[model samples]
Target: MAELLDDLRAETASFEALLRPLGDDDWERPTPAEGWAIRDQVSHLAWFDDAAGRAVTDPDGHRAALAGSGRGDGPGDVAAGGPAGSWVDALVLEARGRTPADLLAWFRTARARSIEVFTTLGARDRVPWYGPDMSGASFVTARLMETWAHGQDVADALGVTRPPTARLRHVASIGFRARPYSFAVRGLPAPAEPVRAELTMPDGAMWTAGPGDAESVVRGPVLDFCLAVTQRIHLSDTALEMAGSPAREWMEIAQAFAGPPGRGRAPVSG
Candidate 1:
């Protein structure tokens, strides 16, 4: 639990650190997320954290919140956050009246409250996410992926690189497990064979999954695998080696991070 909490803190804090240093001009900089300024991105992050916190404290309250806000059924799109353009518009509108300091304060408060809810959960607790249900630990892992993925967007907007964390290996592993689901979500044929993941941990230990075969092999530092899964780094951009039919297909549709597909910016270059 402590490790999970620390991971959560690190993930959220890194984002805040990036947001806090932005100047007025920087806030208006375009991110990889289409039509979204850096301020819009931060506002979306703050909004979701606040909304999810409400869900934890009062699930019914969130339903009412959504209802009262007239966001019912939420833009009728695959993305849980709403239509891609709607999110950008909503975020931009929300940020219009706020300063960077105000955004940071809201971010901090929402995140702190969200963590408080997590601290209260047991290992076995599960919660509903945008798509499938996830155990509490799984939910945290998903959040880690999103944090890193979006952090990449912010970093790309700023032309700065955010260092990868050892904790992200957990997210990559989750991504590996989620390949079948990814295919299912896309209405593609499920892999006839399982792809192997051989990860070299930061501490020099190793983790292996499935059987290495014609399917695929993901190797090198665990961080590379996580980076690829979160779309922070392209599969072709990293040292990770992938082979086989299913592996290649999985890489194309891989979405280890949470949220709806199609919105998160896929890697443009290897």
Candidate 2:
């Protein structure tokens, strides 16, 4: 849990560095996320982070707030085929009038409070989340994943290439473990066969998951796998190598996020 919190703090700092220098126009610029601007992205993160803190400190109040927010269904209530965008859109709407500075302040405060709350919890303590309860480690990792993914959108909007770091290992791990949920959310049966993930990290070290003898294998740079699973980059645009049917199919529809199927990016053409 301590290690995960360290990684989460690093990820948060990295993301904040990107947002710090953006001008008002940059904050309003459209990101790769459909219909969401940079401000919207930060707002969404702030809302969730605040909610996470509330979940730890006051579960009943958190549930009551969400219920009274006029958002019809919480993340846990959405059906497999439901419109995930609508739920997010409603949340963003609450912060619609806030300026970039306001959004950033809100995000920073919420994030700090969340980290503080997490630090005081016991290792075995579970926190309520949008979807389900999560351990302290898993909860922090989830925040890291969301921060990194949305940070990608901000980077894309500004045409800035944020270099991959070892922090991405967390995102990749989530993506790899989410393979089953990815299939299940789409109303498809998860393949019984295990799929192995062999990714080269930014520092040239290999991160392997699943059995070495697994027939289905996904091998590539860890950044590519993370981007592919996060739906930020089209699978066709990545250099990832898929060696089996299950691996290939999973790559095609990979979604590390908890929601309905995402409208993944389209392949870029020459």
Q: Best-fitting candidate, measured by lDDT?
A: 2
Model 2: lDDT to the true structure = 0.82
What is candidate 1's lDDT per residue for 228-255, written digit by digit as tens?
A: 6665555667777666666777876676
Cα miss at 262, model 1 (Å)? 1.9
lDDT of 2 by residue, 20-75 (tens): 99888889898876677889889988988888888889977766765676542345
**How many clashes in candidate 2?**
0
Query: In model 2, where do residues sit more than 4 Å from their true spots?
Result: 60-85, 122-124
Off by over 4 Å in 1: 60-83, 86-93, 211-215, 263-270
C-alpha lDDT (0 to 100) for residue 261 of candidate 1 = 51
RMSD of each: 3.7, 3.0
